[model samples]
Target: MEFGYHHSSFATHDDRSPAAALVDRAQRLEDDGFEWLSLMDHLWQLPFHGHRDEAFVECYSGLSAVAAVTDEITLSALVTCVHYRNPVYLAKVVSSLDALSEGRAVLGIGAGWYEDEYDAMDMEFPPADERIRQLRDAIQLCETVWTEDSPASYDGEYYDVDDLYLNPKPDDIPVLVGGGGEQLTLRLTAEYADWWNLPGVTPEEYDHKLSVLREHCENAGRDYDEIETTVTIPTIIRDDTDAAHEVYEDLLEETDEDTTPRDEFRGLIGTPAEVAAGIEEYQALDVDRFQIGVPKNDPETIDRFVDDVMGEF
Candidate 1:
C-alpha cells in the first residue's frame, strides 16, 4: 500500500520555530518516500492531540506553504470540513492549489464534526443528518463547478448556487471522501468520491465497511474497482517496542495525560517490522493506501517508518 503522512501535530517544538519544524517535516517526509503529505483542517487543536489553545495553523494556508516547500509529494487536508467554506469557493481553492502544485492536489473532505470547533468559531454545527445532507450537496456542487464549462446552477436543501462559473478547473483532481458512516456517507462515496477512507478501523471492521461500500456501489451502478480504499491510522514507530512505548508516554504527558487518540490506536502500535505486518493484514482486505499520523509530529518516528516499514512494502 502507498503511504501518506498526516501532519497532525502543529504545536511548535521548544527547539525551533513552528514554521521551521513544519517545513522540515514536510520536506523530510517527501524525501523519505511518503507519497502524500496531509494536514488536518481544524482551526483549534483537538483535545486528544494537545491543549485546545495550542498553535494551530489554518488548513489551506498551511497546505499552500507545504506545497511550496515540497517538490513531489501530493498535498491536501486529511479531510476538509464541509461546513467551513462555501462549496463553490472551496472548489476554486482546491483547483488553485492544483494549479500551483502542478496537479498534485487531492481533495479529501468529510461531513463536519468536532462541535467544539464550530462552537468556538461561531460556525453552525447542524445536526448530524443535516450535516450529512450538506456534505452530499457540497460534493455535488464541487464536482459541478470543476467540470462544467458553461455557467452552472444547483438547488439542494442545504445549498443553492446560480450561474456559478469556475474557470481554470483542475486536471482531474482526485476526490477522497473520509468517514465511514454506513449510510449516507458510504453512499455518497460510492456516487461521488474517487477514494474512500476507512479511518480508525480494525481489520475486521474495515472488511465490514468494504462490504457495505461495495453494496452501495452496486446499488449506485458504480464500479467498485474505481474507488480506491484508504485507511487513516495513527502510526508509532521506533527501533524497539520499549522505545515506542516511551514515545507514547511522552505524548500522553503533553496532552494533560489524556488518552483518547492514543488509546484509539493501541491495537496499531509496534516496531517497524510489526507495523508492516499490521499493514499487510489490512492489505489482505484490499486497502490501497494508508494515511498515518505521527504522534507529536516526531521526525525520527517518520524516518524510522520509512526506513523500516515502507521499505518492506
Candidate 2:
C-alpha cells in the first residue's frame, strides 16, 4: 500500500509559526518516501482538549504553497467542505493548482461540518440531510466544470450555474470523496468517485461498508474495485516501543485521556518490525493507500519512522 501523511491543526511544533512549521513538514514528507501529502481543511478549529485555539491558513492557499514546494507528491485538501464554495469555482481552483503542480492533484471533498464556520461566516449550513443534497450537487457542478466542453450549465436542487466556461480544465485529476455514509454518500461514490475516504470505523465496520459499496456498485453497473480505497490510518511510530509509549504518554497527559490501550487508538505503534506487521495486516484487508496521521510533528520522530518503518514498508 502507498503511504501518505496528514497535517494536524491540533498542534504546531515549537510555537504557532504555522508557515515555517508546514514547510518543515512538507520537506520531511518529501524526504520520508511518502507518495501523497494532505492538508486538513477547516474554517473554524474545533479543539478537542484545548490544544489549539484557531485555524492557521486558508486551505486553498495553504495547498498552493504546499504544491509550490513539493514536486513529486500528490496534494489535496484532505477533504474540502462542499458548502464552503460553489463547486464550479472550486473546480477552477483545483485546476489552477493542478497546473501549478504539474498534474499531481486529487480532489478530496466532503459535506460541510463545523457549525461555527457556518454561523460565523453567515453561510447557509443546512441540516444533515440537506447538506448531503448540496454535497451531491457540488460534486455534479465540479464534474460539469472539469469534463464538459464549451460552456456547461446545471440547475440542481441546491446549485445552479448557467453557461460556465473553464478554458483550462484539468487533465484527468481524480475526484475523491470522504466519509462512509452508506446511503447517499456511498451511492455517490459508487456512481462518480475515483476514491473513497473513511474514518473512525472498526475493521468489522470497514468490511461491512466495503460489502455495501460493492453491492451498490453492482446495482449501479460499476466495478467495485475500480474505486481506490484510501484510508486514514491514525498512528504514532517510533524506533523504540518505549519511545512510542512515551509519545502516547505525553498525548494522554496533554489530553487527559486514559492511557490504557491509547497506542492502539492512535494506531499502528511499536518498533519498525511491529509497525510493518500492522500495516501489512491492513494491506491484506485490501487497503491500497494509507494516509498516516503521525502524532508527533517533530523532525526527528518523522525521520525515524521514515527510516525505520516506511523504508521497511
Q: Among these predicted structures, which one has the highest lDDT?
A: 1
Write the residue-wise lDDT of candidate 1 on 11-56 in tens digits.
5556776667788788888888888888889887776778777877
The residue ranges of model 1 lying beyond 4 angstroms of the native Cα positions read: 12-14, 260-267
Per-model C-alpha lDDT, please?
0.82, 0.76
Model 2 residue 281 lDDT?
68
Please give me the total number of clashing residue pairs in predicted model 2: 0
Q: Count the backbone clashes (under 3 Å) in each candidate.
A: 0, 0
True-structure lDDT of candidate 2: 0.76
The true-structure Cα RMSD of candidate 2 reads: 2.6
Candidate 2 per-residue C-alpha lDDT over 1-313 given as tens digits, one digit per residue, 9 for 90 to 100? 8988877553575774777678767876887778887877776443432233444667778778888888898888879989777687888898888998899888899987778778877887788778778888888888777888869788888788888888677878888988888887888889888988886455566778888889889989999889998887656667787887787567545542355465345566577787777777667779878777665454555666677777666
Alpha carbon lDDT at 145, candidate 2: 72
